[model samples]
Structures are given as structure tokens and as C-alpha cells.
Target: MASNMGIQIGNAWFQRKINLRPQHRGVHLVTEEILRQVPELLQFSVGLCHIQILHTSASLALNESWDPDVRDDMEMMLNKIIPEDMPYRHSCEGPDDMPAHVKACFLGSSLSIPITDGKLALGTWQGVWLCEHRNNAGSRRRGFILIAKMASPRNQSRRPFTVCIEGNIGSGKTTFLNNFKQFNNTMVLQEPVELWRNVEGMNLLDLMYKDPGRYACLFQSYVQLTMLQLHTMKSPLPYKIMERSVYSARCFIENMKRTNVLKEVEATVLEKWYDWCINHALIETDLIVYLRTTPDIVYKRMRARARQEENLVSLEYLEQVHQIHEDWLYHRTLFDVPAPVIILDADQSMEEMFVQFEKCKTRIFERCRQSERESRLLTSPVSSPKIGAASE
Candidate 1:
């Protein structure tokens, strides 16, 4: 079943979600929307862009852009072909709802485009279209997950590559780091929870979880300070694997502020500090590997692990934290993220997690190895030979 297809390949990958507001039943140009969202696309000299709309009721398409009639014709054709009036088993939602799903299946929810000279290799007449199939009752927010692969620059091969681990509590971040530790030339820096707990043997982490209002400000200050320290710490090895980063601190603090755990004055002060630290370049990250799992799953794992700080933690608190992370990480317009994210579904067992590691290991090492080589070349400094000097 193998076809003799030969082509040059790229090793680096980037992925993120692009959000969009609701639109009426029609085809709308979304190429510019995507371009504006993912500025990283400009970094690639040559690559491929794959966009998958993560919903079943809408779809993606590529067609004429200059003519307005094309969109109207597309809608007209779809409506005619899959008439909403047709009787169906799943019509309890609405007349349009069932037809929307049918049209989505026919049109497809994914699109692929080539990248040339850091631009989508689209034709003059062709452009990406978001075909919203639903009739407007209120609003329908939609999103497309974009994954791009590009050739890594040779110069970056020698820089210190850093990877930040992100996940809900009890989503196996520590365990993942432990397994990652076995790799040579890797520096694994764990979360500062232990330090937060043992500061003067008072256990600020436990106090904050048990009684947030009493110790919210104080705990947040120590958490930010320690996380900033971890962020600024230099890694001698090529692979700098960190358990958590300043971004996690932002999510937790934002949750406290949102839930009224931190008062107005306290929220303002702590958020100002966070903005200052981030603006001053306190940390840098090459990539973020998100250990994605549901809040319910994490709660189960947390209860099973029975960590002291987590012993008194309620399911409600865990749900808030999960929502905060979803907002901060995916909804970047609300709160910007420093690096690109790769979401690994962590709902599976430990053995499956290792398999996931193998999948990502190649790209992780590519980034790290590039840095090591670049460092050696820059530091070793070789002189060029003069013309005809060897003969002389």
C-alpha cells in the first residue's frame, strides 16, 4: 500500500486554538481571522497549515472570495441539498440543528493549506470560509484548532531549550517530570509547593486551600516569588524541563480574585506584581506540553493520591481552577500565553502516558539538540582560513 512519494520534510510543530464569534447561516471569509490570531505562522519559511474546526455543527471550505454570490450560492446549494424541513430522528433541538449536523458532515470541518515564504499558499481566488450552518437565536462561539509544521532554523539548534509542564492538580505533572528525568542532558525543576508548605514550617499552601481569605494574599506573594525564582534559574543542560511556571500562578491568582477569595485591593496589588514580573522578561519558554484531562478525572486522581494540601480541597475549587486554566490557555485574547501549547490527553493510564512521551520526544530533542550544537559553535569560535595560506 506504499506509494513512492518523495518530499522534503520539516521537524518543528506548533498548535493552538483560534476562536470566533457567531455568524448567520452563510459562508464567511476567515483567512484573515486566522492570520491575525496566529502570528507564529510568519516564522515559517515553508510548511503546511492544518485547521480543524472542533465542532460538529459548522464546517470549513475554500473557494472564491471576490464574489459575494459564491457564499450565497454555497448556502443556497447546501440548504437545497440538505433541506431543514426533511424529517429526522434528532429534531428535538430545532429544525436547523439536525440539518446543520448533516451539512457539517458533508462539507467537512477541516482544511489544509501549504506555506510558502511564510504565507499561506492560497490562490488569488481561493480563501478559507467558515460555513456556519445554524440559524441565529442568540450567539454561537466557534473555534478551530490549527496545527502547523515547519523547518527549524539552523541557528536555533544551539540555544537552551525550555519546556514548561501545565496541567490541573493531580494530572500527573510530577510523574511526567520524573519519567522525563531519566533522559540525559535534561534538567528537571519541580514545583515550589514544598517550599510554599515548609516556609518557617507553617505550610502556607495548606492554609490557603483550607482558608483562602485568611491567607490568599500572603500565599500568592510567596507563590509568585518562588515561581519567579524558578523561572529565572538558568539551566546548564540543553533540556530545561520545569514542572510549572509563572503562567500557572496567574491562573490560580485569577481564580482567587474571581471567586472573591482575594479582595479588591489584594487582587489589584498581586495582579500588578504579576504584570510587572512578566513585562520584565522574568522567564522564557520554548514549548508547553499541556497534560489535558477533565476536572472530574483530576478530582478522582487527587482524591486517590491523598496529598496533604489536597486533602481538604473540594471538587468545586478544582472545577474553578480547571475553568481558569481553560480560559487562560485557550482563550489567549483574554489572557495571552507566552509559548505554543501541545495538548496531550492525560486521561489515559501511566503506560499510555509513556507512549505519548515517545511521540513528543523526537521534537523535544530536536529543539534541545539544536541548542547544544549552537552553544558549542558559538563558544568554540573557529577562524576562517585565508586564501592560498595553506600553500604558503
Candidate 2:
């Protein structure tokens, strides 16, 4: 058999809002100065780096770097073209602010540079130019957010990176999602517990557990509706971490039928709803993290923290629920999980579990970026091999 063609994969996207040291009022060659500071860029094969100046006064652009006079001449021409004396209306912050805006308009406040084989894909003579429009006679302040994403060939549209956190009840799903909330490029969509509890002031979970046969169908329906909402939620950022999904609801109701808590009729109705909704859901998860724990551990945690809704939860019920999760997620006895599943040993101390959470968290983000880079490599336009200095 022919060997599968290998692709370079690693971290693919990184965004950091950093301040470059202030420079005197002039143009400067900051390609090396800025790149050396970003180690994440060194991991990918080919991508694009975006530098955006947050401040209106400063600007970023690509220009001649081989000759020192080129930058000096450019700065001189900028002063001549947008002369400070020309403007008078918005001079509140002295003469600099208004003229600064004008100079910035020509130079621009953002630039995107292509990366080839982990280095800036630019002409031998090209370099990154940071133009300081304000008169920073002494004080130089940094003001820019540099974002680099693996660029696909001709822009093959890719969905946002997504993850579904899977675990039995009280397995620290919420806490795990909270850990990733610090990422500016990541969004967390939690389970709609509040909506389920106060549906017309009727505690669905509490009522369902008290009378499983009576409320099983109603509970499953609400779960299916809410999980669908989570599945179809628009991610505000490039990365989304969903607490639970429609598949879990399906498994839960399936177990309810197996144990006779939900009759065959109720289970059939719930399964049909789940199958249609899950198959029709627009967004699919790229990865699933299964927080695996024994029923005893889960039950201990559940009862000790006695939420009124879960008061009816018993060790016998927990065992069956745990088995259902294993059968669906690991054994594949039920529906097939579409994404890769990573089983985490969740029966550890809180401190130890958190440490594991960080490891899992890091791996998920790293893999997502690597996948993006690989996709870009496949469709990217053919180009001559890059040579010479690092940024060239």
C-alpha cells in the first residue's frame, strides 16, 4: 500500500495584544524585533500573520528594508504630505492627534503577511514597517494586537473549532469550561439548566426524578430542545466549548427506557426527536472529552452537594446511567460518536482533576490549530521555495 503523505502540523493560530517599545517619530524596521517575540509562529508550515495597530495614530505596513534611507525618506514624505499646519479642527491633544490620523490614513493601521514554511513569505527587499505618527520625542508605547491564522488555499471556508464536554452529572463539566474562558478567541456555551428548571416555574428535572414514568417524556423533550439550541448556537469567537450536546440527551432517555423508568412508547418518541434534531444540527463537534468516573464517585459527589433536583438520584440509578455513557461513548453499543473521544480519569482530587483539565484544555486547542494548518497546506497556491533571512 502507498504510504499516506505526511503533512506538517503544530500550533496554527495565535493572537496576542502586545505593546512594542515606543520609537521616535519616524519609520522603523521592526520585522525581526517583533517576530522574535512570537514563538508560536515558528510551529506551522505556512500561514498569515495579521498586525493591527489599536491606536489611531500608529500604523503598520510592508516596505523596503534593505536600505536605511528608504524608511527615512518615507517618513519625510509623510510629514510633507500630511503637514501638521494643514489641520485645525480636532487638535485637542495638541497638534499631533489630527495630523497623526492623516498620516495613519496613508500608511494604514493593519497589514497581513503571508508565511511560507514557518517564516514570513516576503520579497528579499521587503520588511515590516512600524510608523509612529505622533511625536514620541522620548516616550515610546506599544499598541497592537498581532493575530496569525493558518491560511487555506484560496480561502476554503472552515467552521469554527468546536469541542463538546461529556461527563455524567456532577462530573465538573462547568468547572472545566470555565478554565478555557480566559482565551479571547474562545467562547463557552453552557447547558440550558436555568431554562429547564424554571419552565413556567415547573422544575422539570426535580419533577421528572420524583415521577419518572409520569414526566420522562416531558423531560426528554425539554432536554432535546435545549441541547439543540446549544448545538446550533452561533459561536462568538473562533473556538467554542459546549458543555453538553443533543447526543447526551439521546443516551439519557435510552437508559431511562432500559430501566423501565421510561416506557417503550416514551423512549421511541424521544429517540425520534433526538435523531432528527441531532442529524439536522448545523454545527458538529471536532472533539469530545469524556470525563470518565465510576458511579460510586459520581454518586458521592452528587449526594454530598444535594441540589434539590437531584435528590432522587440513587446509587442504583447512577450505575445504570454510567453504563449507558460507557456503552454510547466507548463501546459503541448505541449511536456512533462522530468525533474523536478522549477518556479522562475523572476520579481524582479536585486539585489533581484541575491539573488534568489544564492538560486536556491545552491539547484540544493545539490540535485544532494543527488541523487548520494542515487544511491550509492542502489547498494553498504553489509557490517557489522561500530562502534568505528569516522574515524574507
Candidate 3:
């Protein structure tokens, strides 16, 4: 038999394979004892765990609820997609056979799961299952591969070298923006919704947790007003930062489209508004940063802020908003925008996240300068000296 190839690099790699025979039914042991069997597989903090089934008709999984019914449901679904006895040119093996390989290949032969707390981060109902689709369930010598990396402490004080944050209400945008303002040689620009805080008949509070269908016009109108006031006609301050941009209004509308909240007529109006901003708005971004947080966190932080409008927000409603934000950003990535995008996971603390922002800024500025130098070389009549002395 051929040996399985593997390699470990640094203090953060782990792998082990377990052999299984055909007809070996029932849950196989996945305890620390199995890990102890491989002496070289230890010594990593936290990383990805990847497993591959060697046989074409075999597979692996973390069974949910340990229920046979779930397995039956999965098998039924796969068979529907690729029937066993349908076509048979490849029947060189057997009638119910080669297609079994086809089926397994289609279904997938590997899985990668995150490892945390020194164990796989599977839910209570989940378990690892090695599936065998071949009739010959003899000792088939199936294998398991475990990979890991060492976990290091989170960076708590990383500054925002370049940062731009945007999100819906109670989404922790301001909280993150303030932290960025405090670090680096920073100047902060805040969103201008404060002006609409006193608009009469505006039930901004109701819009916080309810469907945005009825309030889209009002919200966008208010957004336009705020942008008009916030965007200075003059050039932005050097090294200064903005919380939201003129383009963010388009992002909000894209989010509304994902939730079925914006009607056809509303979408038309929003497109016009977006075109106007693109053609006429003074706003420009060095890097666009998006904050993604769970709705549960949004509501929790909303209540923490003690705002009357945000007090009544519910977990379920905020979940919808979270989904909207996720979908919107995903669709936005399909387009080629003028600026680079940096997506920040909002679950981290202020200090930890700032470090990430700073790293992004450093990378972005380096790229920007490189692009400028290349452009000068391409367009200039003569070459200038390189910015630095020759390397040793």
C-alpha cells in the first residue's frame, strides 16, 4: 500500500490517521487516546482540523444528534442527486459500484472544522461519522487526519493605521470608530444622524427593530441630509478618518434589497441617489472597513447605551438586520469599487480590533505608494531615484 504523505511546520501542526475496516459499523473512538497514539501530532495552539477519507466509496462527518434518521435523510438526498443503478458504462467494477465512487466524489471526501478549547468546536448534537457506501465493508483501512496550530493571545492594542467603519443602528460602529480615533495620528469624522434626532413624526425608534419597508424613504432622506452637512466641500484632513461615506447610503439600500424591504419604485429612487453621489459627492475613501456583529450583540449594546429608540429592540429582529448586512456586503463584493475593503469581525474588543485596523492601513498605504511609483515610471519623461538606498 502507498504511504500517506504529510508534513508539520512550526509549533502549530498536528496530523494522525486511523485505519478502519469495511463493515465497521458504529461510532469510532475519537478520544484523546487516539491522539496519544501519534506522538508527533501534539504541540499546536489552535488551528484547522482537516480529515479525508481514502476510499472513493467512503466518507466522514460529525453526525448531528447521533440519529440514524439523519444519516438516512442524508443518504436519501445524495441518492436522489446521483442514483446508483441509473447509467452503467463504468460498470467495470459492479452495477451498484463505480457510481458509488461517483456519488462519494460528488458528496465530498474531506471536511475542515475549527478546533478550539483543545477540541473540535462541534455542537452538542454533532459527531464524527465515517461513511462507507461500498458493499464490501471488510477491514478497508480507512484513515483520519488531524491538523492543528498553536493558539496565541489576541493583540489587544493594535492601532488603526487606516480605518473606515459603517453599519446600521446599534451595530457598534461608533464604539469602534472612537477607538480608532484614540490611536495613531488620527482625526475622526462621525456620522451625522444626530441632526435627525429631533425630526417630528419620524418613529426612528420603530424602524430600529421593525421592517424597514415603510421607513426606507425617510431613512434615506435623512441620510442625504446628513451627508450634505458632513461632507466638507474642501479636501479632507491629511490622516483624517471618516465614520461613514456618501457611498455607504448605497450600501444601506443594497442591504434593504436583500431583505425584500425595498420595492421596485424605491430601488429606482435609490439608484438615482447613488448615481448622484458617485458623480457629485466629495467623499473619497482610502479603505472601506465594514463591521459585522451578531444581532444579539447589537441589541445587548443598544440597551447598554440606554437610548430610548433602541430600548425596545428584540433579538429576533436584530437577527434579521444582521442577515441583511451580511447579504448586502456579500453582494457588494461582486462589484469593483474605487477603494479597497477591509472587513472586521465585530465580536472582538475595541483594543484588539484597533490592532487589526492598523495592520490593514499599513498594508494599504504600502500598496498605494507602490502603485504611485509604478505610475510615475510609466508616465514620467525621466526616472527619479528610488526612495531608499540600495539594499545590502
Choose the strongest candidate by lDDT: 1
Which whole-number lDDT from 0 to 100 does residue 107 have in model 1?
Answer: 88
**Residues forming the 10-long window of minimal summed lDDT in candidate 2:** 1-10
lDDT pick, better of 1 and 2: 1
CA lDDT of each prediction against the hidden true structure: 0.77, 0.76, 0.57
List the RMSD of every prediction in angstroms. 19.4, 18.4, 22.2
Better of 1 and 2 by TM-score: 2
Tell me the deviation in Å of residue 130 in model 1: 65
Compose the digit string of candidate 2's lDDT tens values, residues 1-392.
01112222343456765546568888998887666445345434468888887777878889898999999999889888888887479988879778888888877889988876556788989999988888863333454577887653222144678899998988888878888867756656677665566454366778888998898899889888867766664433567788888878777887887888887777778878877876676858899999888988989999888888888888888888788889988797877887999889888888998899889988898989898999889989987667763654
Task: Kindly state the number of residue pairs that clash in model 2.
Answer: 2
Predicted candidate 3 versus true structure: per-residue lDDT over 3-80, tens digit per residue: 233444433354545443334423333333333333222222255667677777766656664566876677667667
Residue 326, candidate 3: how far off, in angstroms? 2.8
Between 1 and 3, whose TM-score is larger?
1
